[model samples]
Target: MKFRFAMVCSSNQNRSMEAHFLLKRQGFDVSSYGTGTHVKLPGPSIREPNVYDFGTPYKQMFDELRRKDPELYKRNGILPMLKRNLSVKLAPQRWQDNAGDGSFDVVFTFEEKVFDMVIEDLHNRYQVLMKTVLVINLEVKDNHEEAAVGAKLTLDLCQKIEAAESWEESIDDIIVGFEKQHRRKLMYSISFY
Candidate 1:
């Protein structure tokens, strides 16, 4: 059977979206979500945050930000990122709510926090489904450039998982193998950069 995938991050605006785009492009049945109280992006100042809810229109937010603080929006690359995010049908969603549906075969989280959030939510709300899904945490930063780099890592891991699946390897084994490779790739990238 073809496996379904889900990518999750804190905001779902950068990291998860990048992986979602790459996996979808590669023909994986994948979705992306956030595990935050509310969707947040960098604002004009560190104290201020641009926040939105699930299903919020990207263009609408972009326009509002542009009108309110064009310089900040442009300087932070929010405009281009929003334009890129337009391809995503839905907005940021709390992972707890989304994961309850039990649709994904595998779930990849960009950080430990999100991974813990997914596990806690699943154990609390969908205990029966917890064992059915494989959740892996891959440490990644929540920035545009880091998102791109992390997307490449996600894509590589997915390809390796697919190959392992084709070889009739167990899900647990596939995850372990991919995770080891992912760590090596991350270390190599860090050292190179």
Candidate 2:
């Protein structure tokens, strides 16, 4: 059976979007969510900021892809196409509410806030069938770099998952590897902070 995975990230636009595409391209059954809401209004509200950078500017990214690969542009607008292929829904509710669903075979939180929130919610829900949620703290030099790093990380992780003797036996090992890598990065950052 295809592995069911949910990827939750702080912003729906950049890193998560890239990973969503890459993971599906690797043949996993994946879904994604962005924490920020994308609201469209006819006229600008006073509260609305015109130059809002949600995650990565998807339009600019897509335009870049258009220049690089015209065929890809014709095939699909990057965000919608990724969403369509991955069955990703931009969730309105916070991660806490999302955790109660008990639908995900594996939930991978891409940000620390979402990770803690999911853990709390899962503990409350106490769902017997739910698997451990994996936290993927993708390391990159800067925010703009997350998409590239996240895509590579996801691809590598997918390869490891596929090569495993069985998902049941090695899922924890996979998670441990990701967690260790993430923590090492965190500790590395502590020096700068």
**Residue range 1-193, candidate 1, lDDT tens digits:** 5777888888746888889888888898888888877778888788988878876887788788889989878888888787777776545666766656777766888888777777777656635533466677778877889889888888877776666644234655655666676563221100000
Stretches > 4 Å off in candidate 1 = 128-131, 166-193
State the lDDT of candidate 2 residue by residue for 84-151, as single tens digits: 43343332223444435555555555566655555555566755653444444444332335666766
Residue 170, model 1: Cα distance from true site in angstroms: 4.4
Which residue pairs in model 1 clash with each other?
none
**lDDT to native, each model:** 0.73, 0.51
The candidate that wins on lDDT is 1
How do the predictions measure up, each by TM-score? 0.84, 0.55
* Candidate 2: Cα lDDT at 129: 55
Clashes of each: 0, 0
